[model samples]
Target: MNRLTAVTLGVADLEASAGFYSGIFDTPPNRDHDGVCFFPLPGCWISLFPLGHLAEDISPEVPKTRSGFSGVTLAHNVKTKDEVIAVLERARAAGAAIVKEAQDTFWGGFSGYFADPDGYHWEVVWGPMFDFTDDGALLFGKG
Candidate 1:
């Protein structure tokens, strides 16, 4: 219960979303089922399923339509400030809209944001206080 294994985004178009993610991830999906796609990362997986179906799976009470902000953001951390800009540009080229340009953060870091085709916000960030494990999982704090 303490660990997060995956983050599933309910997307509008399965094929388009899959393609968009594949392009930015630089790899094909590890698994594609009748209604879902999965991309495996270093520490977890990103799953995409149709919005309506995802809502149905949750419960009949959940709304199928999404609007405004979902109050959630996915993040990709980089090793340097330059890499943050690079990743944001890459995402833009892959069909994401640049929601926020790369800039310095009040916490003494660099970051920016982009909205995916499904309107999901992804933050590309670089923090001096962050590091990575040998296998590439994002590590917080310098201890």
Candidate 2:
């Protein structure tokens, strides 16, 4: 199978979500359609679609909750703890709610969490033990 290429969020307001994400990522949508907007990530991308439409697409999947954690999170791993703080700050300034403040972890990393306008949780982190490829992508390391 091909690599996972995108993480799509079901948003309530297209324009608002687009604006908030564009500011947080410091980039505009690479593509925009009648009800969807696309933001490019390093090896993947983020797609925003209306919550109703997204629900329709996944309607067959039983037990789709309307609110709360959604049992998923998207992570942004940076090279430094400072970068983690900077990202959380940027998210706060872009109208995100900082769910967790950046702090040192028992696992030997620094991280924090934020929720976008659409309530999707994002974790920004810096792990000393993490391995990354030359292109600035995360590598799982040798098996």
Candidate 3:
């Protein structure tokens, strides 16, 4: 069986990326080294690795370009609309770009988007139909 373990981001500077996420998430890195750092999230891990190292690990022939969305956006579900706003503010202060500010959505949720330094998108949301634990794990659902 294959299970998702971590979401690794390619960053221009590992230390800077680590600092950004550490501030926004309010958690220190589980492991930090010269070329990489790791943060353990609710049920997964987020890792920051140098861009050149990541490219070489994947494939030396891979092309590098900063264009278009990567079709992947991480989501952080909070308990209240106020939390949504607060988190967005923290993210913005940590140098994340506000791709979309928090607002009520048609899907019965309040959500927003932010992009990390490398352009990876994240959606911070609050859904009335779901409950999340303090550790950021989903505890209940409407269904």
Candidate 4:
């Protein structure tokens, strides 16, 4: 049996994408070589590679051009509602498109959405009843 170990994103500029995620996640790349950068997250690896190269690696086919929303969103869960706003603010300053401003949600949490240069969506959220370990793993229902 195999486990999903990493999530790699194809970006136009590897260094810029690396910097963007590094700032938000507060973790520097563990390895950067030959136009690829790897950041080790709690239980997975986040990699940034050139779009053309990533396409070639996955298949001889060129990468697909995305339209509208892809229905995929990366999330950042913070300790406080204020942190959600702060994160969104930071992302905006870093050139992310603010798709949705932070606000109280019907789900009893607070969140907002933003998009990277390539239009990949991200949700920055804070839930009063959710907690995370130091290693970035979530522990829910026990605030």
Candidate 5:
């Protein structure tokens, strides 16, 4: 219960979503089924599935409508401030809408936001207080 192995996004067009993510990652999905795609990331995996099917898979009562903020965001952390801008630009070129231009954060970080085709928010950040292990697991407050 303390670990996250995957984050699944309910998307309108599975192929388009998969292609979007593939362009961002510069790698093809590890698994691409009829209506699902899985990209294996450093610390976890990201999966895209048809929105309607995902809602039904949750419960028959769950609504498939998606709108507005979903109260959750996925983040990509880099070691340098320039990388933050680079990632955001890469995402924009891959078809994401830049929701917020990169700026200095009150938390002493450089960051920005972008929305995927399905309107899922993603933050590209670089914090002075953060680092990563050799295997890419995020390390915070470790000097």
Candidate 6:
């Protein structure tokens, strides 16, 4: 019960948004229904639904325009800086907005950022100072 089941994004057009995600993930939606598209992630799913419906489901007060920094980001951890570059390139090729090019950071890592069709920020990163288990779970300061 403690595990997250899904992370859903509010989108303007389900088809276009789903298409954009398909290209980014290099896979089609695991499930597509009348009003939503669902992509399976490692331990959860990413869902896309119409913005209006999402607003209604959550609360009518939810802001319609999600622009600028929404103070939220999604991240994918990689084992190397080359992997980071590869992911960013794929995202760009899939029509993502490359917000930041891969580069060494003061935190002793290499990373880049991209914005998906809905302007959700994602970071591809390689942190030599962090440890990752066989299943890719991250543990800090254990490099």
TM-score of every candidate: 0.95, 0.88, 0.88, 0.85, 0.95, 0.85
Query: For residues 46-108, what per-residue lDDT tens digits would candidate 1 score against the true structure?
Result: 999999999999999999989988899999988999999888888988999999999999999
The Cα RMSD in angstroms, rounded to one decimal, for candidate 2 relative to the true structure is 2.4
**Clashing pairs counted in every model:** 0, 0, 0, 0, 0, 0
User: What digit string (tens of lDDT, one per residue) describes model 4 on residues 1-143?
Assistant: 68557888788887788788777677788653778889887667778888788888878877544456777788778889999999998898878889999999998999999998777898999987888888877678974
lDDT winner between candidates 3 and 5: 5
For 1-143, candidate 5 gives per-residue lDDT tens digits of 68899999999998899889998888998764777899988889999999999999999999998999989999999989899988898899999999999999998899999999999999999998898999988989968
Off by over 4 Å in 4: 1-4, 62-65
Full-model lDDT for every candidate: 0.91, 0.87, 0.87, 0.83, 0.92, 0.85
Model 5 scores worst on lDDT over the 10 consecutive residues at 29-38
Residue-wise lDDT of candidate 2 within 1-143, one digit each (tens)? 78989998888888899999998888999664777899987788899988788888878663334677779999998888999999999999999999999999989889999999878999999987877777777865423
Model 3 lDDT per residue over 1-143, tens place: 78677988888877789899998889998774667888888877888888888888889897544467989889887889999999999999999999999999998899999998889999999998887666777765756
- TM-score of the candidate numbered 6? 0.85
Deviation (Å) of 63 in candidate 4 = 3.0
Q: What are the RMSD figures for all models against the true structure? A: 1.2, 2.4, 2.0, 2.3, 1.2, 2.2
lDDT, residue 115, candidate 1: 96
Instruction: Give stretches of model 6 more than 4 Å off.
Output: 133-143
Query: TM-score of predicted model 3?
Result: 0.88
